[model samples]
Target chain A: MFKTVIRRAGKCAAVAAAGLMMMSAQAAEPIKIGSFLSVTGPASFLGDPELKTLEMYVEKINEEGGVLGRQLELIHYDDVGNASSARNFASRLIRSDQVDIIVGGSTTGATMAAVPLIEQAEVPFISLAGAVVITNPVKKWVFKTPQTDRMAAERILTDMKDRGITKFGLISGTGGFGSSGRTQTLEVAEAMGMEVVADVTYSGSDTDMTAQLTNIRNTSGVEAVLNFGFGQGPAIVTRNYAQLGMELPFYQSHGVASDSFLELAGSSAEGLRLPASPLLVPDSLPNDDPQKEVVQNYKAEYEARWDSKVSTFGAYAYDGLMLAVRAMEEAGSTDPEAVRNALENIQGYVGVTGVFNMSPEDHNGLDPDSFRILEVQNGEWKLID
Target chain B: MLAEFLQYLFTGITIGATYALIALGFTLIYNASHVINFAQGEFLMIGGMATVSLTAMGVPMILAVVLAVILAGILGVALQRFAIAPAKQADVVTLIIITIGASIFIRGIAQVVWGKEYHVMQNFSTDQPIEVFGAVLNSQSLWVLGIGAILVVGLVLFFTKTLIGKAILATSMNKEAARLVGIRTQMVLMLAFMVSALLGSVAGIVVAPITFTSYDIGIILGLKGFVAAAIGGLGSGVGAVVGGLSLGIVEAMAAGYISSDYKDAVAFSMILLVLFFMPRGLFGAKVVERV
Candidate 1:
């Protein structure tokens, strides 16, 4: 009888323990990840795919048992490409939503607008914009994915130097990306002891760039030409360059590195080289390259899921989201300070854009070599090491 | 040196032809109702975008062009009947403001339907550029200039020879007087809009290969065309052609000779100088108020 009573007591203890464990699991709250992106307005092309990638990956993680044994709840707002609105949304995310982390900022204006707030809140932010200013000075809690325009300039100039072309003509658009790239190119050129023999600019809306290009063509000792512009402007410049039949080598910035640019430029794009992400030539990457599989898989998955072409801009978001998840995993908790510290110390994380190795001193740990120099060969992108 | 000058000139003339076509559309509407149609640029955008999408859908290029133009014509009639005719008693300024609203609304709808990517249209002729005196000219430029000349000649003949054309001219002169004489002023107004839409779309299609096309392509082009029309004295066909050509050539010259930075500034300054001397524009009608 005493033996039976002891066994019954053990069974009761087991039932009570199971009930307590269930109660504790129910008490645990979900981890919140906040985002503010330009999902509409002028920057929709950058934000649309970013939002898609985040949503898809968040769902995938949840399905595979979310980070830290808790589901991730994404709180997002559309800034519509406005800086003021982005600030408002960032404030709301920190104060009202009480999110643990942020992994978005589709434009430099939006990103910079939210920096002070995120820093004060001690929250980790991984921006997707491609300007050197975001991470160059190195905020404690901030990191970025895309290689900056400065890095693109460095890569192009290095390649030019390798080819024994020291003097080049520079033509840029007056838009934000183009103008910033022009400044960075000028600075990089000066540092490298190169000569900018001719410099000119065209407005965003100007359809004909032949006049400006003609001026470039006439410049004495202009051994090469670099067009640091984005959108259809570079394509027009490419066509005009061919129309003039100038034999000088041509280089375009990363802004116009896409398949759409290829279509817009057509045969005129042949033999023109540009600094770009390996995403543009995923299949051409050799088997031994680390970025080869990451980029190819990203391109394939993004194309399959979105039913559209994968852009370099979208790759920025992929890297940002992945980096955030990685930092969270390393932290082992949703604590803001821990996540921020983890993000700063992240090393050798393979991503669609590049292999990231973040440090406190280098918030954006990408070298100029991350931008692959690609050439248009027979209407296809050919990888050049 | 000569080659550089020729190159800039070719670029100027090609772009000028497009502006002149768009300005001519503005002239037709301004003459008919004394209201400048701000939706004129939307007509151009519709032409280029529709043709591009149609061709992408496997339609033949020539047929796509025709269908796109027809669609724009219908839209023009809808704008007159639905948007304008209901506010018949509104003043000319109010009507012009309505055109502005109509353009924004049209652009919004286009943005939804097409999204926001620029599209390429193949040249109507060979991709090869013709070289003259070491300056290259795109083969598509010929098609633009050729079609522009034909339309200009056709517009002249229609305004002079046809009875319906005379009716339109009469309505433009005095709407009440034409209505009293059984000219059907509303019908004339609708016809004017349709013809102008057709003209604008043709210009858009021909220039698509040169400038590329997008949902928002009309904004800048429309503004430039309006400048051309204003400089040409608003209602004179000859003036529009001259204004557009001069504006384009001056812009090219400024970019080539002075600086590309000052290209637009120079163009705007030219307008200021012209208006300072001749307030009614180079060919504005002399005052002969009926009163």
Candidate 2:
């Protein structure tokens, strides 16, 4: 009877230990990160690579024991490049799924649509779009990784000014990103004492822009042509410019910083210059530059894993995710406010775009120095001094 | 200023020629079946995408183009036979909806087959532009103009001189009467679809070098071509060409003079005005039933 009593006590102790373990397991739940991107629509060219990059890095991080011993749980959705879809998905991520952080949006318009929702939810949201307005107002909960259109415009103007190009012809598309770039360029040009000799616009679906090109060509004071668009519009403009046999130098925005542009433009892409992230021409970057290693490693790994070329859009996501992880580490907790504070104070973080130095006033943490002026030579990007 | 006007004029004509080709396709199919094939633009997409794929597979440019046109024609016949003829008893509005459904289906298939990226074809000749009075013209534009003209003339002659073409006309006029006269109305309908598809593919193959082609390119091209046909009178071949060319010129001049942003608005507003005034279009038939 005494032995039976001892056995009963031992069984009770084992049950108690198991219950404690279960409670601990509940406490160690994974860090939930939500991501919504334009994975299947017009902006898939941007979102597909970004989604892939995020998935790839998350897996790698999990394999390395995750962040602070808690595995990351990613809830991903396709935004379809629509603003309404992005906003709705973002709300669902915050209110329904209860993600700790959000990372996504492939285009300027879609990203802008989600900004208000993220701000209202007071979640740490890191965007991958390249619009300056995303960070200019400096929301407490918002941050972005991609270099802004304003930076691209400033880079173009600086390069043109260095070349003594005072008069310019600006041809832009009617898309959100294009028009925004146009406004910024005009704003930057005025401040830089530059004159726009001719201004024209074309729809994204326009088959030809030679009418615009011809007008620019006929403008006497126009020393260079600047085309701003993200899709095939810039490539079409390049082709039209070549077909018209214009002698002036042509500059494109950071939007066409992909090899697809060269393929679309064909030989007409030759001699075209654009301000682009160093990720586009990593090999051309000097070894002393900090972005060289980050850019090269990401490109090599991404190409090896996906069997496709890496784009600047993907690099933006990569940087954003890395920054988010860094912030999480610095805060030592997944609390949204702590993470936001950590992100704003992040300094000298070397990324694929540039060395980011974030502060309270700056969320993008990138400037004109982050962009390298690149020229297309023999169907490849060549860095210019 | 003279040079600018001339340049815009030439560019407009070049673009209009391609639109004319598309409009001509719409007219041919409408003439036979009185059903608007909204899938007309997919013919262009298929032609360009197929040529790009075939050329990548080491096919000669000329063979690739010919094969693309033939393939489009066969698909056209299949579409009519399986999709259209199966629902012959449906009303005209239903038939038009069926065509729209077919267009969306074809576009979806194309997106799957070719992916969503834009594809380009090499120009038939050099890319150098010919200078005339300080205005420049690309050689490919000349090719587009020439092919469009030849096809228009060929179609005119076929409709007038060929026995089969006359049979198609008879079937279009009165299907029961044509059947009683021993004409295979079904066969003529199939022939009309094949011919229209061939015309659309030809236009796509030639104009792709200039405009580039993507899966969704057909929607806008089809809309504009429909506008061209409607403005020219749906069943009139000559009217399609004239309406398309003139519309193109007017759009170009507007872009050159007023505002590029309003170019499409101007073209569409003109269509609305034309529809509001002359319900039958500029060259529509004047036949009225003696009620």
Candidate 3:
């Protein structure tokens, strides 16, 4: 009888110890950060560096004692630049991974593809895409880091207005980014009450845009020309523009704002203006600029870590992650609702892309002025006032 | 107004000349074997990319061009000997599919080696635009035109004047009869592939200045070349040239006068219309069915 009593007490003690362990496990559960990016395929240019930045910073954050004393577990999926696959991966991240927060979508199409599901799930999602449509309606759960195409159009038009040029010719590519940029530019132009003398478009695969540029040049009242295109198309247009010898001021969208574009277009890119991230002119930025230090440090760290030149596409990821961390910290927990609220209320958060001042109505809190207009001079980027 | 017309004409002709070069390559191979080489574009890509990378590695431009062309030629020979030759008993459609597979494999390898970024080659002669009657022409366009003409003339002479060229022509005419007459059909086929590859690479190199060189640069250009070849009557040299120039001119005129948005649509529609009327292309051989 005494032995049986001792066995019962021992069983009770074991249950208590197991219960204590469960409590500790619950207290220290990892904060799962889910992501779906176009890590391969055509959009790999955007997702490659983004994945690298995320991986590098996730490790760095863990070493620095992860957010809110819980380790960050990154559950990532490569969507291969397909929107349907992106949607599938995002669904997997939310349903199977059961993540605390999500941070990805390397393209506007991928981001917009997954937005409705994210909204329904009510999870905090910080997107790295640049389409204005992503955050325009301001879904409660979704926020974006990259400046929208609308802002690019606004900045370009504002700069043109400053130069006293109201009439211009517009040529754009028929691709997704190009078409969106074209629409936004037209809307912005209409809003500003400026006249677009000639508007033409070419396919992405077009080898010669000379005929299209000639149509623009022949338009009578055109004082300047604006090109909204991506990839080799814009570079080809730049070359064609120079060949046509139209002395009108040439402006490009942010799509071709990279060193490679300059190399492709060569001397033809000279005097062409575009809106670009300050990261392109890191050292050229004034010391007093708010983003100067942040831009330089991110560029240095990314280049050192990856051994590749930093791209503005990757910078979107950096800002997205930092914003996510900031939101979680501000909320003091990884609770989805608290984080979403915090992310929405984020104000004056200086990031590499721009100083973000997010509010409930403005999930992408970047101002149009955040984009600095840059001019290509002597085969290099020169910041324009 | 005439200047505008000239501008469109120059643009059309320059691009047309490139398409003609590509079409000639397609015509050469189709003449030898009924199989259409889908990997023809890959040879062009190889030529342009090799030259760009070689020049980047500090090799002299002339030497780089020579080496790049030679490399493409070797690739062409290897493709014939290894990929196409292995499936000797395969039907023409199967052989065409094999070429498609081979092209994908080549593209994948190139993407890994060169990375996915466009590279520019300096113009052969000058960067300045040649102004005539207020219409500007790219100096590189002149090189493209001149080189295209030279290649076409050389091909014509090679077929008519040379013994090996005559052997290739004989093989194209009748494989069994050519073999009965002591011509080695396999060797002729390899020669055809090599010569076609050479033509493709030369076209690639000249146009690299106008359209920046990249690993996948050949896909659209190659397809367009094939279209030009088809329009000209797949196996006829003169047809390829006429078809290419007309295709280019129509595209330029459509993009200029009509709608740039429907330029490709218009071009494709033109092809549909042509094939609907002339089932055999413009310059197609008048072959009587044996059966």
Clash list (residue pairs), candidate 2: none
lDDT of 3: 0.93
| DockQ for each numbered candidate | 0.77, 0.71, 0.86
Q: Can you write out model 2's per-residue Cα lDDT over B1-291, one digit (the tens) per residue?
A: 888998889889988898899999899889898999899988988888899899989999999999999999998999999899999999988999999999999999989888999887899999888888888888999999999999999998898899999998888788899999999888999999999999999998998999888988899888888899998889888889988998888788777777788889898888888889988778877778988
**lDDT for position A55 in model 1:** 86
TM-score of chain A of 2: 0.94
Please tell me how candidate 2 rates in CAPRI terms. Answer: medium
Q: What lDDT would each prediction earn against the true structure?
A: 0.91, 0.90, 0.93
lDDT of 3 at B190: 98
DockQ of 3: 0.86
Candidate 2 RMSD computed on C-alpha atoms after optimal superposition onto the true structure: 2.4
* lDDT order of candidates, top first: 3, 1, 2
Q: Candidate 2 at residue A54, lDDT?
A: 96
Q: Which stretches of candidate 1 lie over 4 Å from their true place?
A: A1-28, B288-291
Ranking by TM-score: 2, 3, 1
Regions of model 2 farther than 4 Å from truth: A1-28
Give me candidate 3's TM-score against the actual structure.
Answer: 0.96
Candidate 3 stretches with Cα past 4 Å from truth are A1-28
